[model samples]
Target: MKRRQTNTNFFDLTNLSGDIRGGAISFLVAVPLCLGIALASGAPLFAGIIAGLVGGLVVGLFSRSALSISGPEAGLIVVTLSAIETLGSFPAFLLATCIAGLMQIGLGFARAGMVSNFFPSSVIKGMLAGIGIILIIKQLPHLVGYDADAAEGLALFQPGGFNIIEQLRMSLGQFSGVAMLIALSSLAVFYLWGRLLFQQRAFVKNVPAALIVVLLGIFINELVRMVFPQLALRGNHLVQLPVPGSPQEFLQLFTMPDFSQWNNPLVYTSAVAIALVASLEALLSVEATDELDPLKRKTPANHELKAQGIGNIVSGLIGGIPLTSVIVRSSVSINAGARTRLAALVHGTLLLICVVTLPTLLNKIPWASLAAILLVTGYKLARIEVFKGVFAEGPAKFIPFAVTIIAILLTDLLTGIGIGMITGIVFILREHYQNTHRVRTEHANNITRIHVSLGDHVSFLSKAKLLKLLKNIPDNAVVEIDGTGSSYIDSDVIKAIENFGVAACQRNIQLVFLPARPAESPVYTLTELADNYRRNNSERGFRHDSQPHLHRQVNPTPI
Candidate 1:
């Protein structure tokens, strides 16, 4: 098969129209997502916009993925929230984000992009599911117009002794009918927009559901203001963007990281966590985008990592959140016929332009509308089908998956992933132990014969089971252990078989060993093997862990 060409040139304006159109559509989709994720992260609202710009301009320039879009990701909301909260200051958290960027660059140089492959799919799914559940719980407050803790970190239980249930109860007491009305209406728009897509209408397909939600929100609030001034949403109830009258003021909006936090150990810890999660999310998104690419282009994972690292560095220095290659925006771009990195670059340029020129228009967007977008996103991540699919994969997959979710909800992201990794390893070892060999026993002409066939690979994990199987053999029985199918057999297994031969001598059993190489197959009477074991022990001071230097028997040797 011929290799596909990765020949997309940056200056190739052949697909300029397509790229521009795709970028515009993705920009509409990204607006609410960036705002919502920033809100969720408890960071300054403009931080998300900064990350979006860096993701598109910087990462898009450096990454080999032509269609993938990079921006502040929903997956990192929990991480960002915890990091900011733990550091006690957004500037300090910016320090961590910078460190994370450097770490990602180091990872790229070390060629560690493949590290994500070590993560089990089940655990990743569970992590997303856990984040989804938390997203819903956190957004509930905003959806109900309780914006007191809008800038707080997301935890099932907060430092203020308020749990998810308690927060919901409190939000209920402070619920605004106007906020709920807008949120529900936004959801309704999303549903209707989805239905419109099914009709294959060109105009409907072009319009983003999020853009509709934002417009609806603005219109509804405006209507309320004119008709019932008492119920209009304002202040914290709306999106708050810092409108700058000049370029100097716009530059002032970018906050620099507090370099003094370099000595903080917690900063390094958060950095590591952010780098790992961002890299994994990027790798997953890149892989997904490759599959979606019409040209079937393969992204160079290391380059992508390096690009993300640089993007994060820029974002961090400018008071933005960590970024990842977001699949949602990428898919939207692809569906909109994006053909090159130009599409992403265009999106970033548009975001910069919009924020600088239309901060007031953006501010008119209600938090309730953004919350509604996130609610839909969170629902998609932890939908019933996701759970059902995992459950269908059986306990081997579902157990660790469920455990990761519970652990993340109760403890935190890093802790939950660690626990899930250990659990996945345990299940793997259990499977290896139980399936190392296939065993069969037969009785014919008043004689018992047992056969054991080793699997393709036998490790120390199978030693105990192998011993038990040998021990269960009755006296005067003939046993044959075949290792021909095994490409690699552990030394521990060989030692067990040798010891069993010594023990079989006293029981008057016959042992036949079939080594992985058929030419090395041997038949030996238990007595001969026992004599060799004793002789070898005397001559070489052989211990149990020592190699079993069993020689090939000359002929059919009798006891």
Candidate 2:
């Protein structure tokens, strides 16, 4: 029989090739995204590129994930812009980036990676849906061939008292037929390229749909300029690359942080903001990316944190914007048939080469095509399937998801997530209380017997109801606690049961524990019981021989 391969060596070569192809495509996609996100953050254009390069080359190499893509993300636009404004300079923000990176490293060591797991699935889905709406709104102007200055104050629906509808209505006269054609054609090609022909056609699969769309957009723009100069859109709507004359010029573009101002309050505050936002974004991306992974491979979260920390450290050192695992690029990589980390590494290498050697070529790409790509991405993220699924999960989940989406649109990402998370927690607590606090009062042998079944997991939140039940127990009654049904019994619950057991003994009343076992004995003090009852149950097998019975001794005193 052929031995099954335990190691992942078979895909090693395949992964390399896949990485090169995916990386090339990712690099193409990243160019515009880097610049767009940087511009959005009110930072220098180079900052986004630096973050992409470091995220790919450094984070990719160090990350446990095989397919996650890292770069400057739109999610951090608010925080980055705010930090830049508060710090008063880009260099000061760099100091914060370094400090944030250090904090991330510390968080990893502290095993804080489990933070994302605590977030309800409904809230996370809502957060993504909210981001999708933001992307669609933000890219609307770009699709229509109008480039607005990158700033945070600009609302999605309103731009200086004019809503999106009004702006679109007013800008209709200024629309470039050529740009419109390019945008429409690029979208068309992107769609056709993903069809059966591209999958089965050998030569077609090799072509990057995004690149083709971009080139067509550029060609159309140039053709329009030559044939109808009056209808031509200005170069401001196109992607622009910095022309570095020499190696020295390229080196000089990198800005270093001033260590002398590290102690400034603004610097520390900016660092905290960066650390919090970057961590949240990265964790969220990891969750989404894992869901997208075809093999269902789980990326170690703590490892991811460390990798991001290293990437941010390197990115900041080279004057880059803070880096995180961006869902957009990671999704693109997955959709592009990327099989391993090689794809991410290749993408970074291609980006570096493109920036260094083909600056003019990159600058020729039209912004409309990039906007179209993002529009498609936004649509995918906020698709009807997501809404249908969340709705099917029930109102408890759907309400928070819907609330989070609306909150993000009205407020910001952080605030929106916070609101959704709070709503989700409340629902969870309510569910817990409802499930745990039920009392079944039945008559047994001329005495009242109350049977209370605890929930699977008990926390301090359920303590009050348990205490009330204990205090209200009628005298000369029998109480039976079926702890076997409970997966977890909290310390507070154990304390209440023990105190009640003593009270029952004093009243000459019977307190019986069903399926009684030494592990579930209330005779021991609450401090002696393990926090996790399931572990104790497993260690002490549930055999009939292990069951303990209360023996009545002659003239025994109630203790």
Q: Estimate each model's TM-score.
A: 0.77, 0.82
Candidate 2's TM-score reads 0.82
Task: List per-prediction Cα lDDT, in the order shown.
Answer: 0.77, 0.74
Most TM-score-accurate candidate: 2
lDDT of 1 at 77: 84
Write one digit per residue (lDDT tens) for candidate 2, span 362-434: 8877778777776776777788999999999898999999998988777666678889999999898877775
- The TM-score of predicted model 1 comes to 0.77
Give the C-alpha miss distance for residue 334 in model 1, angstroms: 8.3
Best by lDDT: 1
Q: In model 2, which residue pairs have backbone atoms overlapping below 3 Å?
A: 19-342, 19-343, 23-347
